[model samples]
Target: MSDAPHSGVRFRGVIDLDEHKVHDRPTIYVYEAPVRAWHWTNALAITVLAVTGYFIGSPPPALAGEASAHFLFGYIRFIHFAAAYILAVGFLVRIYWGFVGNSHSRQIFYLPVWERTWWAGVVHEALWYLFLRKEPKKYVGHNPLAQTAMFFMFTLFTLFMIITGFALYSEGAGIDSWQAKLFGWVFNLFPNSMTVHTLHHYGMWVIIIFAMLHIYAAIREDIMSRQTMISTMISGERQFRDDRED
Candidate 1:
């Protein structure tokens, strides 16, 4: 059986389920293949980067054995650097897909900051999250509130971390290296590599917090909102569990 009878119908703002008549929708192909791939790839990359980046920032107690025998910290740094590069490349590919893929792929890159309806969505979604509102707004992709957070917290900070990461790498990569040529300008802005490192570390926390909230919201929506959340990205189809609109 179909997820529900396919329908293009969507509500642009918050709706009270009690007020609207029922309309069933089984599934929609909201996320394209590239978008799905990028989502999971970025998730794994961020997880690895966070754990390894932590060790690189504050290493564990040193081994008692000869320094040459212990390369644990070195391995940690190596993993951090690898994940950083992976994130950076994935960011670029996601940007490219945002242009070539379907409209949903572009939601995170920008926000409808000036739209009055979008602002209303931000407030209503906030209320819904806090349990102050009885019903959450539903969208084909991200609801307005999620769009705002994804653009500012995840997308913008990802770019910030990428630049600062490469800038830090340029330090050891040598001033003549391509990394320096491409990212050395970051030094002109900060004038100190340590400052870049601190900002980069802070950026990591921003992503971490977003990831936590993203997970919480996904699970919450999957249950409370009567819709697919986690599996949408996995299967590339959003299966709505209710006949209610909005």
Candidate 2:
């Protein structure tokens, strides 16, 4: 019995010769193009809103002897409102996609109230990241945790923006304007619109924190799993292990 014959029988692929190359096999596309486009567009809009919002919320020390320089504040307000409109459009499109899009993008599947398996999914996902398990539970789209976060934050922030935005706009429209009347209930509850405005300003920090965490998680997954997690939000394709089909 020759050793050469035994070696030929035992050989697999490049992995059989190299231990370090023992990684998961690659899978096909995961995210779609629309989802990616929505992500980046929303990101840009949010960035603009944050920068302009800071100026709109608190004016800097006035430049000496330039009374007309107050237009800087006016421009900040204009950009903030403009970005808000763009963000609102992106938000509406995402909602519509959640209905007509693929199974992963479907609103019913992502909504916490509707997804029966979401609780288990959350636990499994957490364990997956914590390294408690060798193989992670797979989802074709947003994981349970992400689905819940996006839904809650998007809904609450949109309402907050609308209520506070309308309240502010109503000031210039006069108390009798329809805008004022429509938001009259919110103002009545708060009594001081400035307080509501302050809350709205503070809400940006919450969104920023969420964005930071989201980006970090995406990058971490990409590096660890060899998945194109971040690029999927731009190029709309995620490569995963072939065995990890969801």
Residue pairs that clash (backbone atoms under 3 angstroms), model 2: none
Writing each residue's lDDT as its tens digit, candidate 1 over 1-246 gives 123534555556755644554356669999999999999999999999999888888999878989988889888988888988888999999999999999999999999889998899999989998889887866779989889889999999999999889989989989999999999999999997889999999998999999999998888888887568888989899977755655
Give each model's whole-structure lDDT.
0.87, 0.69
lDDT of 2: 0.69
Please report the TM-score between candidate 2 and the true structure. 0.77
lDDT of 2 by residue, 10-40 (tens): 3356554753334444455655677668778
RMSD of each: 7.2, 6.5
The total of clashing pairs for model 2 equals 0
